[model samples]
Target: MTTIAVVGGGISGLVAAYRLRTRLGPDARIVVLEESGRFGGKLRTVPIADGPVDVGAEAFIARRPEVPALLAELGLTDQVENPSSARPLIWAGGRLHPLPAGTLMGIPATSGSLAGLVDVDTVARIDAEPSVPLHWDRGADVSVAALVGSRFGEQVVRRSVDPLLGGVYSGLADTASVRATVPALAAALDAGATSLTEAVGRALPPPSDAPVFGTLRGGYGVLLDALAAASGAEFHAHTAGASLRRSGCRWEVDPVGEVDGVIVAVPADRAATLLAEAVPAAATQAGRIPLASSVVVALALPKEAALPDNSGILVATGEDLAAKAFTLSARKWPHLGAREVTLARASFGRFGDAAIVDADDDQLITLARADLATVSGVTDQPVAAVVQRWHGGLPQYRAGHLEIVAELEAAIAGVDGLEVAGAMLHGVGVPACVQSATTAATRLLATVAG
Candidate 1:
């Protein structure tokens, strides 16, 4: 009988197990080992005010085919829900400004787009940016702050870029790599776009009528449950300290025993430990990647609590606020809005500044409410609240990240019966994780089935 072991029961691990089961038949033994007490890693959903609310990832890039296709395969097409037309606001300079348009991930294509968000001198500098000669070494990577701060000034980096990047990676532009975080902008620079302004203009995706994001109506829990059931794999929750060692042509997974194939899908650090004995080179490269911790405070307020008409509020770097951002859930999602309670989420902590994530639930919730009141003037006390702390929630894509990923992947590819998939490699979004898992499963199948 063909047997396979999947380490870590996160979305990546579960997806790989599911893909393996669909191909390897009912007789195959698929073992899923999760160190945590639960299956979902960073993608968790909990009950709040008698309804399921996603405390981790709330949505996926709708344009990405991986998630939508996965939904179809799992017969979860009806669970899909799109956000409302309400846009988001950026809180900067002690006020809320409309999120700049004509920009690629907050790197404005023109100064006009960031008029109110930045100062006059900063705007003038941006206006004059096109005339300035850029010195981008082709294929060389630098921090997003280094590139944008040099051309557009620190104001753009703090006010615009940091907020967007912080929301996505729980990181700031100072540490995020331009190539890995915003590849299209880097590609434009590599292709000799002449200046930062030109590169942003060239990299800005064409406007599309389709929604940019989507989420499951009952929260990501619905999808996770469906995947768990359809995979039909033996799940070992709260199982830890599993190690991998080469066993002839197969692989030996501690606690799970020997298996035809294995997929290590935990965080970078955990993955490093598991692969240390079997593939030292891969472990070395994986260990170099760092992770950021964060806290999410979900509040269920009375329906009368007034929030801004916008979808959410993003706080600029250095803002006098404990929370980095807030998702006015009721305003953002139409289905969430229809509920009896007005739901909102306050996100706290960022890379290199995660000490606040360790705060007590009451303290975090207090800060969340105070920040919400300051931003939207909704001071009403919450009817119900939940705090979720994700230690090592997101992996940082620092400068030269792609190179590290390349080296790690190369080392893993040389070893038979071993594969890896997670947020540490490639993009950090759910769609990217799905793609990585699918690729790993396909490659592992090719090696084991032959």
Candidate 2:
């Protein structure tokens, strides 16, 4: 009987273990070792005013087929729903501005759409951009900020790009890789397009009536619970994996016993620590992947509170604000079953911005409330609030990140009975994590068959 051990009980790890069981049949033994007491790493859903709300990742990109496909397999296709409101406001210049329409990651199709949002000089720079010949860096990856700023000017990158990307990855656009973070833009650059706006327009998938993202009616917790119940793998929560070693043809998870195969699905740093003795080269490559921490403050406000009109407000980098972004949860996801009170979530911290995240819950909440008061004119205290601090929560994909990932994958593949899958490997979204898990499971199956 072949038994496989999966470290880290995140969505990636759970999905990998479940998929592996599907392939290896009922006879095979599987175990999931999670360091924390909970199963979902970042897929946290908690109760608020008699309804469930997502404190962490709430939705998955609909374009990515992995998650939607999985939902269907789990009989949750009917539960899929889009956000109630898609419009997001940008809080800049001490006011809220409508996010320019038909923009790709803040790079507007034309400067004409950015009239009052940007200053006259920035607009002038943008108007002159079409005439400016683009010096494309053909082969190598560059920062998204550099690529976009060179063509669109610094204001666009700082105001539009930084906030959007920062909201998703808690990373700075100036340091995030165009190839890894903005693949379409990178592809356009690689293809030698004269105009970035034109290139982005060409590369972007044709606009569809369907929403770009989807979420469950209850919360992501429903999906997580479903996956957990179905996986059937012996789960050992709070069982941290200290080290990994190989014994003959089988792999061993330290302090957790041995198995026929192993899948490591933890964060990059912890993954490096686990792989130290088994695969040093892979460990070295893993350690190089930079990570960022963040804090999310979920606030349940009274019905009378003046929430913004749009689904959320994104805070630009230059703005004097502690919150990086704010989500109008009640306005956005109506399927959570509305109550009398309005629910909102505020995000704080970004790459190299950890003071807020490092603070205690009370201090973090106060900071969040302060930012809320500054933006929305809400002086009344929240009815209730929950603070979640994620240490080393997000991975920063710097320039040449894909190359590093490829090298790491190659190095890890050299060792038999070992595989890795997580957010850092392919993408940062839930769909991408599922895709990575599927890939890892497929590889592990091949190993067992061999």
Candidate 3:
């Protein structure tokens, strides 16, 4: 019987095991090794108040077909829940402003889109951005701050771009790469767009009535449970220190024994350690990627607590607030809003500013409440609160991230019966992880079959 060992029991590893099971049949032996007791990685759900609340990733991009298709295949289509039509607000200049429309990840295509958010001078600079000659090399990469700040001014980068990038990447624009973080804009630039404004205009996705994001009604735990059951793989939790080596024609994963194939699906740093002996070149490239830590404080207030109608509030860079962003759960999701409690999540920490993540639970919760009160004036004490800290939770896609991934993948391809998959390779969202795992499994299967 064919045997396979999957290192890391996160969603990527779980999905890869499930795909291998479906393709290799029930007779095959699949083993999953996770150093942590839980399997979801950053996709965690905890009990807060009377229902499940996601302290980790709260939602997935609905436009990405990978998640929707996976849900359908797993009979989880009914679990999909969409947010309300309420928009989000940007907290800048000590006030809340409407989230600018017609922007690609907060990079406005036109000056008017950012009218109320930025100052008159910044807006004027954006308006005249097209007239300024841009010197973007076709395939060169730079930080989002450098790209957007040069073209639109520092106000645009701090007030407009940083908040959105912080929410998605857990990092500031200065650390994120234009090619990796905002590929559409990079593609437009590569296609010979004359100016940054023109590139943003071309990169902005067409208007669509479809919901931009969605989440499972029962929380991500439901999906994790489903994937675990469908995979039919033996799981070993709290199982760390496993090493990989070649055993002639097969691979030997210590403690898991010999297997026909192996998948290293951990974080970039962990993947580097695992692949050090088997694929040194790949390991070297993987080690170059860095990670960021973050903390999330979920607050459950009385149903009558008065909050803004907006979905959430993003803090601009240089804000005095301790929290970076807050998702008004009760105001954002209709299903969540119907509950008896008002829920809100305050997120703290960024790429370089993650020292705050190590704070004690009580201190973090206190800071969360203080920041929440400062932003929305909803000082009602939360009846229940939950704090979750993720160390090295998100991989920072720094400039030249694409080139690093390309070299890593190229090295892995030269090896046989071995593959790697995780958030470090392509995109970091759930959809991207799913796509990466599916591709890894398919390719590994092809190699093993040959």
Candidate 1: stretches off by over 4 Å: none
Cα lDDT of candidate 1 equals 0.94
How many backbone collisions does model 3 have? Answer: 0
Residue 383 of model 1, lDDT score = 93
In order, candidate lDDTs are 0.94, 0.85, 0.93
For 1-450, candidate 3 gives per-residue lDDT tens digits of: 999999999989999999999999999999999999899889999999989999999999999999999999899999999999999998999999999999998999999999988989999999899999999988789999999999999999999899999999899998899999999999999999999999998998989999999999999999999999999999999996379999999998989888999998999999989999999999999999999999999999999999899899999999899999999999999999988899999999999987899899999999999988888999998999999998989999999999999999999999899999989999999999999999999999998966
TM-scores, all candidates, are: 0.99, 0.97, 0.99
Model 3 worst lDDT run, 10 consecutive residues:
240-249
> Residue 246, candidate 1: how far off, in angstroms?
0.8
Tens-digit lDDT string for candidate 2 (324-380) = 999887778776426678888999889897777878889878988898888877776
Worst 10 residues of 1 by lDDT: 240-249
- Over 105-191, each residue of candidate 1 has an lDDT whose tens digit, in order, gives 899999999998999999999999999989999868999999999999999999999999999999999889999999999999998
For this target, which candidate reaches the highest lDDT against the unseen true structure? 1
